[model samples]
Target: MTSNGTSIPVTADGIPRPGGAGSLAGRTVSRIGYGAMQLERLRTDRAAAVALVRRAVELGVDHFDTAQFYGDGFVNEVLREALAATRDAVVVTKVGATPDPGGPLPLRLAQRPEELRASVEDNLRSLGTDRLAVVNLRRADTGPGLRAEGDQVVGLDDQLAVLTALRDQGSIGAIGLSSVTADGLRRALPAGIVCVQNSYSLVSRDDEDLLRLCTDEGIAWVPYFPLGGAFPGMPKVSDEPAVHAAAREIGGTPAQVGLAWLLHHAPNVLLIPGTADAGHLADNLAAGGLAPDGEGLAALDAVPSRSADDVRLG
Candidate 1:
């Protein structure tokens, strides 16, 4: 569905903006999509979450990323109620681990082939859809306590087998991977993988190499936490005086500047910045319209990379 009463534009370079990308299960999604993890907080503020999601659609966000583990089923319910009537929208979800009582803190792999099948059923029920647009095999680092039986986590071959089986059955339109490393992506890319959901942003450039690899391979790299995942990070160009001065001069939030930097950085990058607050959502969507010049872009690129030890992957 076209948002803000503006038709989805086909850029001069011919790439479409929001809702211009090719179909994912007959749903034309915007490359710059919305990640729906914030919907999990709906239990505390249902109206706000629903409004933010609907408003995101109104702001040209036609693609939404969610997962069965988001709210133990709540987020999907919100998406179902909010966007069910929309004609052209893509809803993506994942399967791999079941959330323990604590939260996404510890993921217990429920991806044995049978369990994977069961999770697909649960996703379908929660999402209120017959076929999922894209289903990712979600992976996360095993905590200290959960690492003993590491084999419990589904291996690449096993996960691929399950996905291929489901694909043959027409349960999902496309397959993707979430939280995978460079090695993992290399292994999966040959299997017709269409997308890779990794934690990437201006402050956290840990995925830079992976991002380049995906761009070279013609795969979509959907980045989560463009400004900051939970806690905010420092400026993009740590030592660049000009970028810092410009950030202050614009009177705009540092976040708006950071997001604008990402949009200008790469063509294959698709950002899914999640927020429960309507104001923050509006600010994020507005970042798409900002055009930072060569000096600004160079200043951001000049930012020094963080030490390997300092980069933390969730």
Candidate 2:
């Protein structure tokens, strides 16, 4: 399937494997990438997380999504240890949110110019890298206590000013945005956004307009929750009857079917499904090789879209 008139690439066997390579700020990465958020919560040992990262690298997954806030900086350390020998991997981490010193569940936005610098420095120290591959300026409006009284949120230009200065100083190679709306993108585009990470899935499609905008602008749309797994009030993809039915027909797990739909849904849609177990990681990665039939695709598409309020970033 083509997205916004762009052809979806497939392998010779008609399966999709990473959907051809795409570039983010001149750094090439696989379309199907690994997200490291799961490492923060996995009951498995830290060694298992490290092994999973290495296994992902062996599976041709060069794009890794991580954040300094994840695992209170432990996830980045795992990436540092796993990818130390593999220098070509493109590790994308986010700033603008930190675990509230008061507690673990609530995340506080840290977008102050100096705070942004500190966050980048923390990521640098944790990831064991002199310069970050990509740093996303995550929006604060989506979180707690950062909203402006009326419409006067922190200026995107101000944030970009700090990021650009760091880029000039070789602390960051590229800058992107996270959880931003269409208007936010318009305001930040002049600052040169190479990608946009947002909440998008079959059930949570409120960001469809933003996805279209990203597609039109040639920016990579990296959906964080591709499987619609666990959000505060939203339903998981596995809970949907259509998803299960389609999975049964397609001879794969519900998660695989959901990911396959994403692979076929758009040419610019990059996936970052995270997992801790090696077997589950292998299964998730193999979703790239599953192509749903037209009937199955329609069934997957028929799943109802959840409201925007159901989305709460952890």
Candidate 3:
């Protein structure tokens, strides 16, 4: 039943699998896709990161997420090299904020109409693609937590108008929002919102309400921090008893159970677990078939939910 030799079982469609399809691009992506944020030298060694991405494809991960801010272009380049020959893989990249050319930096907003167009062109060039599959407009906020409700500096209407124009011009396939609030999503949903990439994980469920909104509106709720906030000291995958217990019962790994929980919780939920290890990459794709029902789902739901992490960049 597995397609592409990855652990993900094939659905009726010829694609590898199917997740929640709230938008056009997500609808096009296979379920159990890979997220490529951590596959860069900024966080880990470059060689290992590149291997992780190539291994993800070998394991049948057809959806890859990236942002221009990730290593300021390093992550996207890694993805281009990884899946350039894969026939069905989809790449989702972000626009709006571009980081400075160095370490531990702050994000600067870069989404004036012309800048927005140029950013898309830059992403296409850096990723070595003709057109982007999905383009999310990231908001840069000066806040302490991951989901801060700061004053609206970049008018949401203006941003959506630009995205709509790009979509019309076929520069990108679909549009999404990242690091945004429920109110912010409500404002942008009218302009063909496809997905909302917020910081949600077993530890961080502050955006549960937004997840519900995505479900109600038929949009994919793509959780960025599926394991935890992206930090070295973040809790180990085995720390969540629900994940560990599920893994013990299903004969899979804790990381797989963590991702499976997200998959089983909501059909509209899409997970993008990032890694820097090739073996971990293949192991992650295997988790998709470790179906957890009844007590397993209940156990995952019982895990204590923490407030939004203090990390600003999600």
Candidate 4:
């Protein structure tokens, strides 16, 4: 059924296939969603990027993860155009950093209370929507990205207060967080967070406690870098021998197996694996069907988390 209770066709939920249904932002979304970070690579070919996003929707991708700083708004612009003709897609975007196209990291902290608000508005303007579906406040308290500096440092409660007010005023739909710690999530729980975007993967279990916390609270755990390999020294699931063995056992690619393990690991987990290429996008969505057998799961489970990647997957 669609959100309004109309019966939907099998094509409407293609990749999720009904059995793969999951919840996010208080709505039903396909278990496998599309992330837009990699869209940055397609900035020069706007038409192809827009087509990829629409193609994702055609393939039943209802949940979308994006950030304003992505491609310094180029990615968001691609989404704005791609989504203009669609309806009822859960478009989630993150703030707390602005793009520095020429910088080494390509982003700078924009985490002050007002800076957060500005980023949300920038997203709205770029997406051409009055209200954002969800606005994830990316904090610098943890790793995998830039950290907050002197004045950029702001209290979590203060940040939530602003986002909460936006929800009340109808500027955004719900609240979310990225690159946050367990304690930070706990402190912001009262504000009604609908999902979390920490860096987690099969080879990175440092945030297992936080994943459990979200599951217990019924909050969605939308992990970034679900396959690992986001940064150097971070353990990539592709590099783990156990993951390879599990992939062979399950008859799926190592990347697909890594994603399958996440879905199997927790019910609240929603994958937003991003890809610029059509083939990779298909593989990501198809991961929804790659269930690991008990032996596969155990082999994957026994693989230890690398402490070095603990440097980031907070």
Candidate 5:
């Protein structure tokens, strides 16, 4: 059964339809990858978390997005245990943020070269890997955190220097950027940006231009909050009337329709929708197989756009 409580359909060969594949930093990965953010918030036991990761791999999901800041390394620990033997998995993690020890829910930006190096070491230690598949430098000045007066942030070059050094040292495979603007991308591209992870969905198209830029440059656009974050007052893609109507028409769930729209929206898009529930994972992966018609695409495109601040995370 899927997240919407529908029976999963298989092809005539009895094989479950796999998610489509896309290239990220020269590596081919399933467009429908798993995100580890939800694992940080899951109240379930460790076994359950590990099981979910294994299940995702079993379902042919190769790309997994995670960060050391998530659950103060709890999520990466879970991934370490789960993916220990899964050599084919592509783990993408980020730097530039750490949980503030004094606060219950505040993150401190650690963008300095020294801090970034330490964070990278922590991620490697926690995930039990020598080299990460991709390391996205989370721009603290942009997105939902502190706003920068200028397009460029201080110490960005130094941070990229650290990442480039790591890549040269074989500690990481590819470099990326997160929560960055088009100008930010322009600055970081010279340092070798292979992907851009930003907030984007049917209701949040603030990164539309950046997405195009990524496409033009052959960089993968990995969208966070692809279904819109579940924070209060934030728009939910599944709740959109157009999504619901399209779901009905296609015999799928609203979430499935939203994800389908994203895949259809761009070839460079690589989805990493996070979910702790097995059922939801199945639904998200199945969405990659959906081919939305022109009508469905039109409806999805017509959804109102929300402010970038509304969907960005600190």
Candidate 6:
């Protein structure tokens, strides 16, 4: 599926193959991919961190979502050691933020076009790769995280210009956007986005319109907080009564049911659920294979969707 009629083969690890096939920037990748932000917690034991990353590869993880600013580049450092001898997977990283270890927040906005290019270089250098597979420009206009202020409020086209130039020069494979609004995405469509990373889940679904836009444009909708990002006033998918019911009827965990609902909801949706724990990673990988019965699916579909302001722990 490399833009030709010939079929591209995915690696088989004896995991369930249903709902496994999907596209990321014209490259076929597992619909279920691993996110690398959680690796920062494992920095104290680099070997253990690298081992976990390798274990994921063994489990058939092909797409790795990461950021150079994550752990002040510790995550990519581990990836560098773990993936040094291998280049089989597509490594997707993001920009528009820098680590602020001393600040109240872990990251601060760097949304200017120049900062975007510098962050890409940081990723390239940290990852020990001359070129990246894909680079998502993490915007701050809207957030499950920080918002851009004053000087950080650069236009989307300005940010994309540098990314497009890098892609043209072969420094990156494809370009994507994260935390973008529908209007922002529409502006970026001409830049040929391959995927989008937004905060979406079974409960918090304010971005359904944006998700639908991605579906129509053939852009991979990679939900960041897929099980809910655990922000205040936000509900995790596991807390939903319908999700638990689906789990009971489908013989799956609430988490597995929630994730399965996403896969079944749309063919364009891809998942990047992250974890520092090995067992949790296995559970996430297996979520792609869960098969919900009609009743289970119906109960899940009937669950009420809420926006960030409307939901609270009640």
Pick by lDDT: 2 or 6, better one:
6
Q: What does candidate 2's lDDT look like per residue over 1-314, in tens digits?
A: 11223344543334333646666777667778899988976524788788889988777788899999888888999999998888478899999878764743546677777888999999999998899989999885442124433233567788899999999999998899987878889888877788998767887787788888888888888987776655456656788888888777757788987787887777787889988778988888767666766776787788888754434443
Error of 6 at 46 (Å): 0.6
Which stretches of candidate 6 lie above 4 Å from their native place?
Answer: 1-9, 12-18, 309-314
Tell me the alpha-carbon RMSD of every candidate. Answer: 5.2, 4.4, 4.4, 4.4, 4.4, 4.8
Sorted on lDDT, best first, the list reads 4, 6, 5, 2, 3, 1
Worst 10 residues of 6 by lDDT: 1-10
CA error at residue 57 for candidate 6, angstroms: 0.7
Q: Candidate 3, which segments miss by more than 4 Å at Cα?
A: 1-26, 42-51, 101-114, 140-152, 231-238
Candidate 3 clash pair list: 22-219
Compared with the true structure, what per-residue lDDT tens digits does model 3 show for residues 19-59? 32223454555557777766654355666666777666665
Whole-model alpha-carbon lDDT for candidate 5: 0.81
The global Cα lDDT (0 to 1) of model 6 is: 0.82
- Candidate 6 per-residue C-alpha lDDT over 1-314 given as tens digits, one digit per residue, 9 for 90 to 100: 00112232455444433247888988777888889999998888998899999988878787889999999989999988887765457889999999988765788889888898899999999999899999999986554667667899898888899999999999999999998889999989999999998888888788889999999999999988788746777777888888877777656688887788898788999888889999998988877767656766777778887765333221
Report the lDDT of model 1 for residue 287.
60
Local distance difference test scores for all models: 0.68, 0.78, 0.70, 0.83, 0.81, 0.82
| Whole-model alpha-carbon lDDT for candidate 3 | 0.70
Report lDDT (Cα) of residue 260, candidate 4: 82
List, residue by residue over 1-314, the lDDT tens digit for candidate 5. 12333334332224343556678888777778899988965645888889999998888787899999888899999999988887567899999878775653456667667888999999999998899989999885444443323323456788899999999999999999988889888988888899998878888888888999999999999988788755555567977889889898878998888888888889899999988899999988888778777766787789998865643433
Cα deviation at 27, candidate 2, in Å, is 2.8
TM-score to true structure, per model = 0.83, 0.87, 0.82, 0.92, 0.89, 0.92
Top-scoring candidate (lDDT): 4
lDDT at residue 168 of model 4 (Cα atoms):
98
Residues 169-259, model 1: lDDT tens digits = 8887788887777888888876778788766666667778888887788677786656543423332433345446546655556676776
